[model samples]
Target: MIQQGISPRPEAQIFDADTHLGSNTFSIGPSRTSDGSTFLAVNSHQPWEGAVTWYEAHFHSEQGLDMTGGLFPGSPMILVGHNRNLRWSFTVNHPDLVDTYVLEINPDNPNQYLFNGEWLDLEVRQAPIKVKLLGNLSWTVKQEVLWSVYGPVVRQDHGTYAIRYAGMGLVDIWEQVYRLNKATNFKEWQSAMRQGGFASFNVGYADREGNIYYLYNADLPIRTEGYDWSLYLPGDTSETLWTQYLPFDDLPQVLNPAAGFTQNSNSSPFQTTLDPDNPHPDDYSPTLGIETQMSNRALRALELLGSDESITFEEFILYKYDMTYWADSDVPRMVQMILDAPTPQDADLLDGIEILRDWDYDADPESIGATIAILTLYDLARTSKSFLGSRLVGGEFTSEEVLDSYQRTVESMLEHFGRVDVPWGDINRLIRGNVDLGLGGGPDLLHAVGG
Candidate 1:
């Protein structure tokens, strides 16, 4: 069978280029904390203008809010924590769960499509979308919902596309949650995950007995080789259809790796463990569309913690709070470019450049250089959102752009604080009712907190 239409490089590696996916979240693996307590931490920083919320929540014998099963805040899953036995948390396990299929609509009858050398009629229905116009006035719009042999059909003027995603027709999320919360040991937890209810997530777990595990909770399709699953595929043939999900053991996971640590910074599962021990890409099928990209934090984690054979509790905490950008990160490269860029014969520009040049790269609260450097980096990120991913793929920042951002940062600092040498603690302040303190970390730091 000849494949008709696809991008030239259909098998090109899929990238999690969506910066918004992990903007406010970064999860790390289990490690023994300073208090000798095993901790699996996720930097759950949600921007808020109102009341402060916390993940370290406690629930007594209550219903809902005071209920037996309280929600995980803006989520349908129940809060799973200590119960005289164990504690657990989850990270998003992003695998290719959806595929787009292009079908040839029968020219003779638009309602029918060619599938497996046969014409099958599409199931069409109308979905009512009601909108409120004004006082007691509304409008009901009927939208067409079409179903093809592959899955849901999306009609366009040029062509039609069908979507096939994991957990397409399943509603067993609550059941999965219940089983997860009730699981006592690894055996029970494994059983619950094997049920494949929630579709995709990364499970980080540790128990009182020192058992640590990281599960790439995924129900991936067993796609056939030779077809690039990353691109839109031809739907006319049955060969493109996947029938079963990969078994649990086939998923990438690290159970008490020899390195004594496991982490996923929303990066590829191939980098979840220590060097040489992490899962190899060759072990899994490329058609699964697993990520090959690693986030900045993942690179940082490996750099800071990978070498330590046995980490003390203090070392663990220190590594977690690392604020220095990885050497090869875009921030460093861009900063270097800004420093090397020709100064515009301006006092503020010269002073700012000197400060950045003479200081350390750490986002220390008290560092005068850090204030301008961090602000300028934030400005750079906002202005050029294309620079969000790894430096290798996010396109290099030009010297002109870097100098422009440098000038802007200098001016903004002089305008807001009346001086360019303001301390990072002064700008990145944490304000409560009356108590305000200088915050040490900046965006994408291991301690990742931001507005």
Candidate 2:
């Protein structure tokens, strides 16, 4: 490791990768919308999974439904869109649901465990796992799947653990979606949400009745007050067991926010609207584990949307496609770190630094320095502050790393494209069939380029 550091071996570094779903959704009521009707907009990006398609459903003796979104074949959308008086969409809310408990097994029988001062037998079952060796030739092998009062148990070489996750035995999740589709008003919608099988998602809603809402909806277990839920709990007692869920009314929500708009970019629910209307983080329990980071998309959305009181439909769409990463956002901060650093004496490094400094924050096609700036983040994915894990959710990188990444980006661009001053449009493109268009947005922007 020491010898390799003598030369520029960026490849010697190992990246710690983490990824989570990111999406943007917002709603506007009649007072703020263009057509005198509520406006709901969603840009759910799942590039690997593809986008949602419009669909219509008509059932015998039931209300017809029109939807402009698709779902995974087996999954249901309690986040119904344009089905009734209201339209709704979802952004993933990564609430705490899963918990692990360290098991203390009985010495005489591994199948027995101690719970609340008494030893009890674990409920063990063997399920058949079918494996295929060749085409149409399969074998069934029985694997032990154990269960306990805690929920489920896993035995590994290091230790025994029991896990408890919310909605473990859920079967009527589809029913909730179906009910949500048929709900014509706010009351009906709330009743449907009371069923509460949704594992993760923050719902954004707007209705023809001039109502708008944002909900940080989840089926989260009500954990006990004392223990550190981040670590494994002691399984010997029932103290770690969390049975109840926060009531539907307790989930973070805002209805008809004073700001005239509500939005979530998979960020904190506390900042869903203007400062006056945004939820107070201290009001909710830390045990719920609500997200508190502001995304670049969220910051941009607030700057654009909240700036105007009488925003036109054209402006609404314009705000949705806003591509500039906010000044305080990770991208700009990281880039500034590189720019403010002492310019290296090398010719190419000086050229790279100048490109970054001359660049405007926008990712438009004609932006001269945009190519090198964006590619720097792209080339050094995990190592780049604004490109790591969830950039919008606040990532970090050192000044040294940022400068190194910029150097690599300049080197790569010269070797391949043969120039550092190439347009961002030339490098980052949206290609379909034989046609190509310049992608005007960077990652996590409201107008996502790839997704």
- lDDT (0-100) at residue 26 of candidate 2? 88
RMSD of each: 4.3, 6.2
- lDDT string for model 1 (228-333, tens) is 6767788888888887898889788877776666776666788877767677899989878777776666678777666765566667677778877777766677
Deviation (Å) of 225 in candidate 1: 2.5
Score every model by TM-score.
0.84, 0.89
Model 2 Cα lDDT, one tens digit per residue, 1-451 = 1222221232332212233346789887766666665677876766643344423333323345444445653444424456647778888776777777778889899999989998899998999999998999999999999999998898987668788888888888788887777778888887887887577689998877889999988887787787656556778777688888888787889999877899988788998988788889898887777767777888888887787777788888888888787878766776788879986887877877787787768888787676777777665575654456464546766778877888888888789977778887877787778988876777767776643
Give stretches of model 2 more than 4 Å off. Answer: 1-21, 48-63, 74-80, 384-387
Off by over 4 Å in 1: 1-16, 20-37, 49-71, 74-80, 129-141, 309-315, 342-344, 389-395, 429-438
The count of residue-pair clashes in candidate 1 stands at 6
Measured with C-alpha atoms, the lDDT of residue 113 in candidate 2 is 90
In order, the Cα lDDT scores of the candidates are 0.69, 0.75
- Tell me how candidate 2 scores on lDDT: 0.75
